[model samples]
Target: YANSTASGGRRAHVFNCHTDLYLEEAERHGWLIQIKSMIDLFDEGWTLRSIRKRLKKDPTCTIDSLGSPSDRDITPLRQGPPQDELPDFTLDEMHRQIVKFIVVDDQAINLIECPEFRRLIRLLRPELNDADICHRTKLRELILNAF
Candidate 1:
């Protein structure tokens, strides 16, 4: 009776071991398939945004399955409070820095007047608009005062 019981326990253990191995193999196979699909999408020139949208629609797909840090969604830095809410001293310092850039770089006063330049500046500092930007005359005055 003891020998029969021991043999039955061994058989059960062997069955469980096989089942676990099979499950592990299946998981690995699925992961490989996901990786291949991602690679294929890249080959097709799919942008990260497009891929992310597709993943959102597919319940089974995950961003992690891409396995690249560059593929991950990046959060933009938090913008500071609007300049109107800032102290006068802070605004003065900001203007001084702008004047310094123009003087140090030997940039033309008219550079600030360029539509594209203003657009780029606004893009970087959303709080600033044309009115907040120093005019060429004001910039010139600041430059002269510094010397």
Candidate 2:
């Protein structure tokens, strides 16, 4: 009864997709697909056992089943391990390493000439044509010398 009103002892809430409020609500609580899945399950008349089995298989398929967020004060999620911390490499050092890594494979040079990849680049920024990327990378040595 997702898109239904409550006439027989049930409550009803309205959601307007046209507004940013709908987007915020969905974003605030992650698992955008779960909402649609639940609606579809309701429409298909899924049993509680079937729903439980599906939820067990994919844990992210349900909301916080034990309690709602409002039921308790929230705590910050855990951070990564100490080893996961950022390295202390300098910008220039990182740049040099990146360039070395890229140039190791000559195939990367051919990637610059790819039509589909060039289309993607142009789509990202229409002002930046295929020649822009190809010329920039190819003429890097000269450009760096000029700088």
Candidate 3:
């Protein structure tokens, strides 16, 4: 029942998952495991392309070689400690964020419409009408670096 209300805007988060264990758990927990389109993944709050890119970039998390059409059960490939921390991630959510990143990188970083950035700039600079472009740019870079 989401509408165009401001509060209804997306809340993006960066998430990583035990892709293999995740799909398996889907069957266990009865979460939706139906094959979905890349766009569906993005709509689910993920960057489908980024998921692929992440798997390619890092081998340990590549759940499946092919996209949604592939029915093969993905093998678990955890390399370190078991992924149990609750930093804010689910298997589907992980896919969503990665799919979102494919289309939008800022949203992937959870920086879209950041309140802190807006508050900081208003509090520190207050006004930057082309006069403090260089200073503002450097300051912005510094803030990003702090993250």
Estimate the Cα RMSD of every predicted model relative to the unseen true structure. 26.3, 18.7, 14.2
Q: Write the per-residue lDDT of candidate 2 for residues 36-129, one digit (tens) a residue.
A: 4334443454433344445566655452241222222132211111345545655444334334323322124344456886687578557754
Which number leads on TM-score?
Answer: 1
Give the distance in Å from residue 99's predicted Cα in candidate 3 to where it truly belongs: 27
Cα error of candidate 3 at position 142, Å = 42
lDDT of 1 by residue, 39-98 (tens): 454555543445545555665645435343344344211121234564354556766867
Better of 1 and 2 by TM-score: 1
lDDT of each model, Cα atoms only? 0.49, 0.37, 0.36
Q: Give the poorly placed runs of model 1, Cα more than 4 Å off.
A: 1-89
Error of 2 at 142 (Å): 7.3
- List candidate 2 segments past 4 Å from native: 1-101, 104-107, 135-147
- Residue 107, candidate 2: C-alpha displacement in angstroms: 4.6
Candidate 2: worst-modelled 10 consecutive residues by lDDT: 5-14
The reply for model 3, stretches above 4 Å from the true place, is: 1-15, 33-147
